[model samples]
Target: MGTNVTVSLKALLLAGLVVIALAVAYLVGDSRGTPAEAASGGGETGSSAKRSVTVGGTGEVTAVPDQLGFSLEVRIIRPDLQDSLDESGAAMDRVLAELADHGVTEKDVRTTGLSTEPIYDRSRNAPTTLRGYRVVQRAQVLVPKLEDGGAAIAAAVRSGGTAVRVDGIALSVADPEALLAEAREAAVDEARAKAEEYAAAGGQELGEVLTLREVSPTYAGEESWSEASLSRSYASDMALPIQAGEQELAVQVEVVWRLAD
Candidate 1:
């Protein structure tokens, strides 16, 4: 009976050990499957880690201006401020009326600058009293038809609008925003091409676009197109014929791409 009892106890213990071993094996197998399932599932794959490289460059395109700007200024000088103002007003009215007759609407005619100053004779050392006042009024005209710019100015001057000035002439896109968008896309393409070139030449992958900038374009008409460039010259040198040349609008950009390993 003692032997039989010992034998039964040993059998029970062995069965428990077997159950524990089987549980451990099942747990191990389940845990190992999780990593394999995750790898094959919605998680990012190693192929996505391939590095992309980029380079940078700049490009510029020049075009002529299709529009011209005109400034018709009328100046009157007299010993009396009111007198000069009256004379100037009459001349300005005639000039503006003439412009309107030529299809220049009120919307197109914009007041640019005006001034009234006491005329002083500073030739002598002694301070001279105000002899008269000089009154001047100016308005700007933007002509979509550049060929008509000079003709318009001539008409204004002949209409008694003296001291006409050509403020500036510029070239621009009909839709500047659209032009800028196109230019930006071109710049990005150029940058990407550069990156690919670098990569082909044994560089690492492209990381990110670190910096990007677009340069402001200026109208460089005959010379540089500043607001004062043409007018100041025309005032000092009126001999130049009125010829509204083509204007240009431009956009520039710079991009920097980080290098990846």
Candidate 2:
């Protein structure tokens, strides 16, 4: 009996020790291995690793401006400032009438500048005598047909509104929003090419695009348009020379790409 009891006690103690050891291992494993397992995708396999680079590029596009903006002005000189202003108004009224006669719509004709300044005979500064008054008024004409542009100016000049002067002729795309999109796409393509080149230089192929952005659209105006404006002369029946040249667009992209091995 004593031998059997001793054997039973030994077995029980062994079993208890095994259970306590398992409990302690479970607690320690939960504390240390939780973060490592989660970071490793909570499985035996690990998650994908990423590497990347950034690059910059510039792009430009040239296109003829499709629309034109021209202005007509009438300046009158008189002995008195008010008188010059009145005469100037009368001339502009006549000009508008002529434009209406030529099928010009009210929307197409808009009055711009109206001002009266005292003319000073500074040539002989003998007390700065007021020679006369100069009254000037301006109007903008939106001409759709490039061919009719000259004829319209000639008609204004012959109408005795001889102060008929052109202010400026600006060229622009009619549908800027739509046309800018194509230019932006081109800019993006250029940027991608540059990125590829940069990636090759760094010994890595570009991976998935991390980010994309658009900077802003820009314009290049004709240089002569401004030069012709300052000179005071009516645009005659002679065809106005206009060259729109080109417009520029830009896009910026920050692409974080995984470098290839």
Candidate 3:
């Protein structure tokens, strides 16, 4: 009987040991997470251990415009539609010839608008009456020679006579690459200065650049001609005065630098 009791106690102790081992194994597996969680980066990967600073910089360049753009129109009103068209066509031909003589190439002149509409004379008490047929022909002109812009406009007006209408003119830079390069250099220099100041304030140093990117530039304050400011009738023989004023071009950039130890 004593031997049997001892054997039974050993069996029970072995069973209890097996149970404790299984419980410990299950707890460890649960703490380690599931298979799916392990595949999808469940734990702290510590990828963002490196510190960096991002800063934005801006630069501007003021340059004189080198190109001129303007529009001209010829309008004639007559009792007959054919007469209106013929008169306006002849006036436009004169204007084009004058422009060609002044250095405007054929490619630089484009017929933008042409129409013939009936003119209505409206009164407060009377019914609207058809006055005449109005014909209009418009052309967009670009002059590469900035100095001769006023002369070209005056010649065109003189050739077209009193029927000619001069619209607003806008000045622009023909090639902006050189100015853009200068502005970009300025922007990068400004960014570096800002980064250095920030690094000093943080009690650290700037390391090599991690990333450099250019932001799309916005030219809001740049000066340009407005229709309301320059649009008018051209009936006089006096020369039109043109000024190729300075315009502002801007560039912006975003830069990231790693923090040094």
Among these predictions, the greatest TM-score belongs to 3
- Give the per-residue Cα lDDT of candidate 1 at 62: 47
Per residue, candidate 1 scores C-alpha lDDT tens digits across 1-261 of 899999999999999999999999999876665554555443334544333333445444445555555656778889989899899889888877765655567777799888999888775668777789988898877655555554455556556634444444433334456555665677677777877678657646666887777777544565324435444434453322445445445556666665555
Model 2, runs deviating above 4 Å: 1-52, 57-64, 101-104, 122-128, 208-213, 221-261
lDDT of each: 0.63, 0.65, 0.80
- Candidate 3's residue-wise lDDT over 1-261, tens digit each? 999999999999999999999999999988876665564345322442356788988989988887777888999999889999999999998988988887899898989999989999999999999899999998899988877777788888778877887765777787888988899999999999999999999888899999999987644332344332232324454546677767888999999998775
Which runs of model 1 end up more than 4 angstroms from their true locations? 1-56, 122-129, 161-173, 207-211, 222-248
Quantify how close model 3 is to the true structure by its C-alpha RMSD in Å. 8.8
Worst 10 residues of 1 by lDDT: 47-56
For candidate 1, report its TM-score: 0.61
User: Order of all candidates by TM-score, from best down to worst?
Assistant: 3, 1, 2
Ranking by lDDT: 3, 2, 1
Backbone clashes in each candidate structure, one number apiece?
11, 0, 0
